[model samples]
Target: MRHRKAGNKLGRNHSHRRALLRNLVTSVVIEDRVETTVAKAKAVRPLVEKMITLGKRGDIHSRRQAAAFLQTPESVSRLFATVAPRYGDRQGGYLRIVRTGFRQGDGGEKAMIELLGAEQELGAKQQKRAEAKAKKREELERQLAEQGGNEEGGSEENA
Candidate 1:
């Protein structure tokens, strides 16, 4: 029986695995959303959270640590300036993973990992805008129908 293994190996050596995790974490911080295999997404979630936790500290050591892991100055800056602020009052759970079903090429399980608060707020705003647009379209159609009916009545009276 398998016992005491902490993480998914993804069939890579230690250095490669570390590099892969750092890249994944960096991309997640930069894009704020990523589509990836479910296993990798799950594995990278905690690493990204730790980076955000460090960013939240907003200290010199944390910045250096983040820079070392991220390997990009811009990404580190974004992590501290944009990402960390969003999670200010919250304690943990900085991400949300949604299963996106199977991938076509290899049939691997796919998922979308997104920073939680921003996506949810954006979704709400989009939904509201969509609803308003639909309502406006319906009102226009009603007015058009009313005008059409009036035109028809006038035509009949003229005939």
Candidate 2:
């Protein structure tokens, strides 16, 4: 059986795999969410946690290390500024992987990897959207009611 193999190969050579992981980590840091295969998500988790730990350190050396690993300069800054602070009092487990079913073509299992507390932001967005939708619906109904009233008044005057 397979033994002593600590990581998944992910069908890529060393350089390609490292690049992929860095891009995925950067995406997750900036957007706080990423949809990828379960294998990829699992592989990206540790690296991302390490970055967050570096962010927690908030030192020049840590920043340099993070910038070296991550894809973009912006992502490096965000990791230290926003993402790390969100988990200030917490210890580990900064990410959550939710299975989003399988890819249709290859049937590979897909998952969404997101930061733990992103749901609060998502919830606020949903609430705002619902409020706007309700306001629009109310306006439409009021317009319809006014149209019906006008039509009836006109018909009665004609009669």
Candidate 3:
């Protein structure tokens, strides 16, 4: 007789479930996107929306409420400062979930939950990461080339 029972338990007790959701919401707020299990993403969706709604409020009370729920002060600040401002003039539906694939270990269905209208920020972040990786790769290759040249020269001198 599971009647009127709302929200998935996610196989955890109340305290654990609450903690998990809080962490997930905080991560989504700070990172703008998070890849997690589909069920978790779905469960955390409404909570994230609520946080954003509070952020939209942009008041002292709402800020306190958000700070109480979210894990870090930085996330609360970012939510109010950046995320909320970005969603101003929009009605709702601040986030979107896209099914990515199954996880390798347990085959759990995975999804990416992202804030709407964050493509530009995400793109820029990705570009920066790619550039850093390329720079590191180039540096490593140069070091390898120098080492190889030194080795060959040393061998010629020995001969």
Measured with C-alpha atoms, the lDDT of residue 131 in candidate 2 is 100
lDDT values of the candidates?
0.92, 0.95, 0.97
Please name the candidate that would achieve the greatest lDDT relative to the true structure: 3
TM-score of 1: 0.73
If scored against the real structure, what TM-score would every candidate get? 0.73, 0.76, 0.93
- Where does candidate 3 have its weakest 10-residue lDDT segment? 86-95
Task: Write the residue-wise lDDT of candidate 2 on 54-152 in tens digits.
Answer: 999999999999999998999998999889999999899999999999999999999999999988876887799999999999999999999999999
Ranking by lDDT: 3, 2, 1
Better of 2 and 3 by TM-score: 3
Residue 30 deviation, candidate 1, in Å?
Answer: 0.4
Better model by lDDT, 1 or 2? 2
Off by over 4 Å in 2: 1-5, 123-159
Q: Candidate 3, residues 24-137: lDDT per residue as tens digits?
A: 999999999999999999999999999999999999999999999999999999999999999889888999999999999999999999999999999999999999999999
**Segments of candidate 3 deviating more than 4 angstroms:** none
lDDT tens string, model 1, 5-118?
799998899999999899999988987888999999999999999999999999999999999899689999999998999989999999999999999998999999989877
